[model samples]
Target: MVQSNHETIRMNPNIQEKPETLTKLFIRKFKKNKLAVLGAVVLLIIILSALLAPWIAPCNPGQTNLANKLAPPGADHWLGTDRFGRDVFSRLLYGGRISLLVGFGSVAGALVIGTTIGAVAGYCGGIIDAILMRFVDIVISIPSIFLLITIVAIFQPGVEKLIFILAITSWTTTARIVRGEFLSLRTREFVLASKTIGTRPSKIIFSHILPNAMGPIIVTATLLIGTVILTEAALSYLGLGVQPPTPSWGNMLEDAQNFTVLLKAPWYPAFPGLMILITVLCFNFVGDGLRDALDPKGNL
Candidate 1:
């Protein structure tokens, strides 16, 4: 038994060393970043609050008590009531659910479409690459927000519609980035070797190329979430996103835009704006950390 084990170890000496994956290595580096840890904690707290909103919210978010309109923060209403007497605190909690959902959902859709398009373009090369890249450029040349507004205008402003608009507009960036990465990687020795060895195209693209290209993809996806959230707020503010009585962060700002509400209930927009700022900032910080951590050459 001992002789057989020794022979196995001799056959593959590399087996004695620890095998660390990209995710494990990235995690190790991420743990060393203080700002990333703080950002992660803040994000976790927000996610938990969103998940537990029903149990934690003191009052009904959509329920209106006209008599208590514009009431200042106190024991009964921690964040106070808005113009419609809906609890600001509760609305903020519920609003986060929609905002975060849009951010994640749109980005997920973008990743799927972008990865597939980019991989095909890069791996196939020639006419296919030229055509796909031109399409990407055409999409990129147009103003994203304007395009989104135009599309959403046709569909009527709602959360699902807004998500679709953002997803369609957002995929261009992902495709551009992924295409660039794959373009550089496709000409490498390993890819050439895989081709020479008769490896399947799908296997070469996903099993080899995609794994190596994921670092930048992940970083971009993280940053895209922040962008998505900000875009959703902008759409909502323009009355082209989440509709009334829905209690989104953007429309919450709309409620506070009135002079009387600004003076009487400053907390309405203040809380929502603060939440947006902090959340976006955290995502940006996390993205930066991820970029530094995942750089294969340690060039951060």
Candidate 2:
């Protein structure tokens, strides 16, 4: 027996090794995707820079000097001066704070509202489901951009208002995704067992089915953040986003829209525009990685 065991160990050194935890497995798989790892690193740096903007930014984002306006990139201003002569680099860092805030804040609200509505509708499976699903369908029929534009046009745009508007408008998609997941998961053996054992409906919905459904939710939320940032940018470009003196990536692009400035300093628009592109792409890469990592079949 000892000889046989020794042979097995020699053949498979990992025979007695403990299995990798889900988190470790996920991290390992995520790291294997070079683009995802790169995106994660770059995004982390951007986030940290934005969060630490007050301490690290060399100059105030709102301070302006007409004499230095439109200066090209130099030692004093890394990305050059905007039309207002604000340090482009400092504004970029501060802008990231607002953009990320809106992105994450809106997505969080959407997730909560959408998940709750979808869970109730899908788990109940009758009139409640019909009513809720119909509402979602109605909301879906309306163009989200038009709805957003009209709402912003009606109410003066601020960071908080924009986040709120984006959340309410965007929740339908999340609702549908969550509802589909719930519908599929509600009939599973584990759920049936829970029901049979007298688990509270709320407990079963929240604890049992929700955990299983979280993989899709997480991926969706990640993608939605990028989309929200883009939306905020568009609104700001239209002159209804974060107002003057308050720097946002969106309004930065708006500032760069002057015909003379665009011709004089292409870097003006390019800076914020590039930030948006990189941020969205990084988010997409990370989302793709998470989707793959979360798939049980992929792990196998």
Candidate 3:
């Protein structure tokens, strides 16, 4: 009788069950994505290279050698020299540092602003929600690129200014996503239980609700970094971003816009363009993988 009882307990579904933590489940799912793994490795390499640029760079990125102007790739100059005789390889390394900085900085700024607005609107609802959402709609209606160009043209263009502009303009999407998540999460059982227990509204929202909603927000942020990088590159290409002598990937391409250089030294434009493509693609793949990993329904 005791042996039968032990077997019955062992066979019970609830007694035998082992629940996985969300983070463990997410890791398990993410590891299965090959492209995401590849992207992460490539992104790590790019970031490390950018950080170690000063040590690894063959020559001074800004120091010009007029005699070696437009020199083709060789042992002395692996990627060749630009019109100003600056080392392409060195400039690319330094430029990546600036590009990555802009990408991360802008996204961080936007994330903070968007999260605050979204959280408040979603939690408060009614008049506040209507007002805040209408403002978001208004901002979204504007052509962001054009707005960015106009703003940069008005102010002195620099790294800090460009980051500020991009952050301010780019937050609407994050706001919408966060607000949507919060809307659904506000009514969840945990949230109601917290309210019933007399937990502070702020504490309930921040500690309970925000933690649950972070999966989507994080995925959005990863994807937004790529978008911010592209926008910064475009602004730099138009000569309104990081400015001359500052080696951002976009400004490097701007310098290579000459027809003669295009025909004669393709490496000048090709390297920077390739870096941008690779960086954007890697971020996108990681974001997609994160989304699939975080979804509980096993949907990709």
Candidate 4:
């Protein structure tokens, strides 16, 4: 009778699992995504190359060796030289640093500010939420690019100023996202239990609520990096961002905008444009994979 009962317990279909930790589950899901893995590898290579640009580059990106002006790719000058005799490969690697910096740095700034505003508004509700959301609505009503152009025009263009403008303009989306998240999460049993336990509102919001909403925030942030890069590129292409002599992909294309150069010095436009494409594509793939991997619904 004892053996039969033991066997019955062992064979029970309702037996619970050893709960998989979040890290373990995340790793398992992430590893299953081949494209995401490839994206990670590519992104890593780009980042490493950017960090080591000075050492890896054969020629100085800014130095004008007039003798090598517009030189095509060769054994010495890999990926060729630009109109001003700057090494294309060197500038590309260095440019990646600035582009990626702006992309990430601006998003970080926006994320912090937006998350705070959204969390506060959602958690506090009533008048505070109305006032803050109204402000957000006002900001969102304006054309973001036009607003950015106006701001940039007033402040003058440089990395810091550009970051500021982008940060200010970019946060609206994050605010909306977090606000929705907070609204939903505030009603959950865990949140009610925390409140009932006399957990401070601030602690409850940051500790319990924010963590639950981090998935969408992270996914949005990954996607935002690509958008920021493209925005910076567009601004630079318009001659309003990252001034000349500072190697950037957008300005590289701007410099090569001449019809004559487009046909003659094809390398000028091609390489930088290719970099933008690859970087954007990689970020998008990574974002998609992250969304699927992190989904709590297990839909992926």
Candidate 2 minimal-lDDT segment of 10 residues: 1-10
Question: Least accurate stretch of 10 residues (summed lDDT) in model 4?
Answer: 1-10
Expressed as tens digits, the lDDT of each residue in 18-53 for candidate 4 is 677988898788778888878878998998999998
| Residue pairs in candidate 4 whose N, alpha carbon or C atoms collide under 3 angstroms | none
Put down candidate 1 lDDT per residue, 1-300, tens digits, no spaces. Answer: 456755777888976845778678878888788898799889999989998999999988999999999998989999888888888999999999999988999999999889889988988889999999999999999988888889988999888887878888898878888888899999999999999999999999999999999988999999999999999999898889899888778888877899999877676789999999999999998998888898878742
Clashing pairs in 1: none
Query: Order the candidates by TM-score, highest first — what do you get?
Result: 2, 3, 4, 1
TM-score per candidate:
0.90, 0.94, 0.92, 0.91
Model 1 weakest lDDT span, ten residues long: 1-10
Deviation from native of the Cα of residue 245 in model 1, angstroms: 1.6
lDDT of 2 by residue, 1-300 (tens): 456765877889888855789899989888878898888998999999999999999999999999999999999899899988999999999999999999999999999999999999989989999999999999999998899999998987999999999999989888988999999999999999999999999999999999999999999999899999999999999998888789889999999999989899988899999999999999999999988888888954
- Name the runs in model 1 displaced over 4 angstroms: 1-24
- Displacement of the residue 26 alpha carbon in candidate 4, Å: 1.3
Residue 22 of model 1: what lDDT?
67
* Candidate with more favorable, higher TM-score: 3 or 4: 3
